[model samples]
Target: MPNIQVSALAPSTQVIRFNRPHARNALSLALLQETATALHAAQNDDSVRVVVLTGDDKAFCAGADIKEMSNTGIPMWGQSERLLAWKTLENFPKPLIAAVEGYALGGGCEMTLLCDIVIAGQNARFGLPEVKIGAFPGDGGTQRLPRAIGKSRAMWMIMTGSLIDGPKACDWGLATEITPAGGALARACEIAQTIGDMSPIAVRMIKEEVLMTYTKSLDESLSLERKLLLWQTHDHNEGIAAFLEKRRPVFSGR
Candidate 1:
């Protein structure tokens, strides 16, 4: 069976599942490539408005494949297919949600940072344990984790290789929501569907604007928002008319 499985959950929502349960869904080169292919396909499909990433209830992902790493070393950090795959995921324009359960460690934890929203199960555990093995998280963990949580918390996790459970993760700002055991995927899909029902153009723009806040100066961000506000689109007109008509807006993503 394929290590990764992509399935359509709704007209506008897609779910990508990591299928390597035996290894706790440890990331392999082939799996990363397949995931990138799936993400590219979803991004190109106009019908797909949101993507949900998840694994089995036992584990979201255990991180990079240790056995493979022992022989191949860390191929993802350099100019390799895995690096390209990681880039593809990071650059995906549409909304990406991570439904996490069990363990999200090292690269697995890093992957969640790439998503726009993270919904973790009560049993979920997150950490960057690479330091314990004489390695470090090379997949944007050092950078993104600090941005997600505070600097000190991220420092502790990276330096000590300790883990935090779902509630703690949510408190630390690493996770957006915490659900009951086995409910993360369902809650994530619900959120995806709600977002899908809105104006696709607005959704995309909002995501862009929020991400821009990380690097853009305040003046630059305001200028960009002003430009977006002035830009005429069918969705904007539809939204205004719907409010006046007391009805739902039908957006064509224009």
Candidate 2:
């Protein structure tokens, strides 16, 4: 069987599941490669408006495949195929939602950080345990975690290698919502469908502007938003017309 599973929740919402349940869906180089390919395919598919990334009910992901790393070692920074694959995942333009069931540790947690929305099960466990293994999160954990949950909390989690459960994750801002132990995927799909129903141009613009606000100066971000105003898009006019007509708007990607 393939390391990952891709299915459609709806015509516009895609579901990508990590399938390696035996190893708790630990990310191997092969799995990472497969993920990049899947994400790239989704990005280029005009029909795919949203993606919900998930794993089995037992585990979201345990982290990098430790067994593989034991034999081949962790991929080093810069100019590595592994890094390139990660960049592909990071650069996905559409909304990426994470439906986390169980453990989301180390690289797994970092994956959640990459997502625009994270729906975690009540029992889901999140951590960066590399410090316990005499290493640190080699992925974007150091950078993204702090940005997601704030600096001191990230520092405590990383330095102590402690795990935070679902409720804590939500309170810490690491998770957008908390669901029943096995219900994260379903909830995520619902959210994805809601996003899918909106105008694609507006959704993309909102996502881009929000992400940029975190990295760019306030003036630059505001200027960019002004330049990419939704009023300039056909979908915006359609939305207004639909509202006045008391009917649904049919938004074209244009």
Candidate 3:
């Protein structure tokens, strides 16, 4: 089997699984490259409506593959590769969800944080433990972690390298959902399917609006919403008709 497994869960959903269980699904250069390739492919494929990133077996990811880094000698190349991988996930146009189980530490946690949504197994653990190894998370960790879990918590996690489990992650809004053991992927897929069932154009617009609002003041967000809300005019009639008739809304994606 390949180090990374990419498979379709539905006509509109793609699941990419990290297969390096022996290494706790660490982000080796090859694995990061493969993951980026998969994300790139999904971005261009109209058939794919949602993408779920996960790992096989017990561990979600144990961070960078130390063995590969040790062999490479030049750390900058590996660092750059992982950074690219993080950027790919962060900017993926379509909805991305991380289905996390076991450990999601260091680079793993960074990867999960980049996704639009995250579903974690009840036993899943998360942290940025690079400090323990005489380094810090370089792959968008300082930026993404604070955005997700707030500056204080992100700083504490990075500085101490302490792990927090699923419930706490949910409490901090770092995780979208927490499921029973072996249920992270399933729950993630359910959310993906719900998203896939919606109108793609509207879905895309909503994502755009939310991202824009993240940096904008409340007044600016409201002002921008005026422009985007007009998109509803394209399909509002069909949506209402379909809802009243008790049928599926066949969006034209206008």
Candidate 4:
């Protein structure tokens, strides 16, 4: 079987599963390329409204494939593919959810942090132990972790090479929710479905607006919001009308 598997959980939600249990679903170069390809496809497909990332066996991911790294000496092409995966996850317009269980370490943790939301199983453990190996988190972990979990916590994780359990991860804001054992994937899919049921244009706009907070000026931000809502499409009108009627809005995604 392929190292990665893709399936549709619902008409509007796609699930990507890492299947290399022997390596603890480590981020091998092949896995990185496939993940980027999958994300690119899902981003372009209107049918795929939400993307859920999960893994087989007990590990969400064990970070880089150490054996491969030891043999290949970190090929430049491999590094580029990995970076592409990181960017794809980080910039994905649709909702991205990580269902993390077992261990999410180093690059694994970086991958989870890129998701718009993270749901962890009770047994999940997260860390960035790059320093232990005389390296640093190069796959955007240094930049994104501080933004997600704050400077102090990210510093502690990176500097000490310490790992945090699921509960601590949630408390530190690294994970949005914590579920019972083996429930992370289910919860992620549920969250995805909830988001998928919303108006597609509004969902995309919301993502755009949230991403703008990091770099855009106040004027530019406000202008984009105004411009996005000015579409005045049938779906936009339906959203307003449903809100006025005081009932759940059924979005046709026009």
Alpha carbon lDDT of each predicted model:
0.93, 0.90, 0.85, 0.86
Count of backbone collisions within predicted model 3: 0
Writing each residue's lDDT as its tens digit, candidate 3 over 29-100 gives 888889999999998988888899999647888997766655445664346666777678778888889999
- RMSD, one per candidate, in order: 1.3, 1.6, 2.3, 2.1
lDDT against true structure, model 2? 0.90
Better of 2 and 4 by lDDT: 2
TM-score of every prediction relative to native:
0.97, 0.95, 0.91, 0.91
- Model 1, 30-140: lDDT tens digits are 888899999999988999999999999989999998777644553546647778999999999999999999999988999999999999999999999999988899899
Off by over 4 Å in 2: 70-79
Number of the top TM-score candidate: 1
Candidate 2 per-residue lDDT over residues 69-143, each given as its tens digit? 643444443327789889987888899999999999888899999999999999899999999988899889999
1-254 in candidate 4: lDDT tens per residue? 68799999776999999989988998887888788899999988988999999985489999988666644565432466666767777778888899999999988898887788899999999999989878888787899899988999889999999999999999989999899989999899999999999988778878889889777998999898889767776778888898999988878777
Clash pairs for candidate 1: none
Candidate 3 weakest lDDT stretch, 10 residues: 69-78
How does candidate 1 fare on TM-score?
0.97
The candidate that wins on lDDT is: 1
Runs of candidate 3 with Cα error greater than 4 angstroms are 70-81, 232-235
